[model samples]
Target: MLKRYKKYSFLFQELVHRDFTKKYKRTALGIGWSVLSPLLQLLVMKIMLTKFFATGIEHYTTFLFAGNIVFNYYNESTSSGMTALAENSAIISKVNVPKYMFVFSKNISSLISFLLTVVVFFVLAALDGIEFTWKITMLIFPIVCLVLFNIGLGLVLSACYTFFRDLQYLYSIFTFLLMYMSAVFYDISAYSDFAQKLFLLNPIYLFIRYFRKIVMEQTIPTIWFHLLMILDVCIVMIGGFYMYKKYNHDFLYYF
Candidate 1:
């Protein structure tokens, strides 16, 4: 796979550039929207849910921002990846490029936006009086895990979407439900102990919780927690790659 990627590295770069440019094209604020959009979301949640959901939480806005950045990245990457093949059908049909490259490019674009939002999140955290600690450097672990997980997930979703047009709509509804369940604005402690354990089953929530631990709590997550994240990424990648390998040929027909 590395050899294949290296041989087509130029094509990958082109696709990444095109996708990134297209995402912000014709927008007045352009890339500024990446930072501004999440901040605006934080503002709305802060105003509406603060009194109700943020009780006993210190630096609630920063907490919410941490969750939002991680979840938003996953949402954007998977959603864009779901349509990667269909959207690029014409090019794929004519060119010899790798099918997964299209999905990867979309993820790269989303990742760029995600990184921008994360920088803003840190700034917001400082503004909220959350002190930076060396422990914050540990966030790279979860960030790397989430990125790999998103890539694997994108591959699987793009493959499935090629065969099933209805998946897009269903996925939209699923993400809506996922957002509420992720505790993006609320404290998970408000829930019963069983419910808190159940929320841990959610990979998105797991990543969010990891980020909050490092940023808001100023603590490193346990080694067991790190192993759980690694396990989640491995499961998703193995399954996704298996699907892609098995169905790569079929994608041309669906497209």
Candidate 2:
């Protein structure tokens, strides 16, 4: 894959550039919107949920940031990625290129947006009185795993979407429900042990929990926690890649 990426580096870069062009072109704030958008969402969510849910969590705002950032990245990446092949149907039908290139570029754009706000998250954490640790460095592990996880899942979704346009509507609803399932503001300690384990079944929740454990709790997650996150990535990536290989040709028909 690295060799393929190197072979097609120029096209990949252009796809990324085009994504930025389409998203920020003629906008006043330009890239500044990347930072501001998530903060605005954080503001809205905090306003709505803090009173009811912030009761016991220390540094509730920071906790909210942790969930909002991770979930939004997943949302944006997969949403754009769902249309990767279809959006570039012109280019794909006319030229021979790796379809995954479009999806990768889309994910990269979403990742850039997420990283900008990560800077704000750190600054906010400092002001909110959360102590930092070297474990903060390990936060990148979950971020990296999440990028791969998104790509894998993006592959599956884009494949499915080519054949079923209604998937787009269904996905919006799923993500809406996913926001709450991710425990963006709620503390899940109130749940029974079995229910607690069920929350870990959600890969997004696992990543959010990782951030919370590091940023708010100032601790590293156990080995099992890391493995579980990786396991989720592996399963999803394998499934996505397989789905694409099987259906790549069929995508042309639906497009």
Q: What value does the lDDT take at residue 202 in candidate 1?
A: 91
Q: Per-residue lDDT for 70 in model 1?
A: 91
Model 2 per-residue lDDT tens digits across residues 1-255: 899899999999999989977899999999999989988988998999989999888899999999999999999999999999899999999998899999999999999888988999999999999888788999999999999999999999999999999999999999999999999889999999999999999999999999999998888999999999999999989999999889888888888
> Which 10 consecutive residues of model 1 have the lowest summed lDDT?
183-192
What TM-score, over all chains together, does every model reach?
0.98, 0.98
Compare the candidates by lDDT and give the number of the best one.
2
Each model's lDDT comes to: 0.90, 0.93
Instruction: Identify the runs in model 1 with alpha carbons over 4 angstroms from their true place.
Output: none
- What does candidate 1's lDDT look like per residue over 1-255, in tens digits? 999999999999999999999988999999889888988988887889888888898888888888888989999999999899999999999998888999999999999999888888888889899999899889899989998999999989989999999999999999999999898888888778998989878999999999999988888888888888999999989988999889888888887
Any runs in candidate 2 off by more than 4 Å, and if so which? none
Clashes of 2: 0
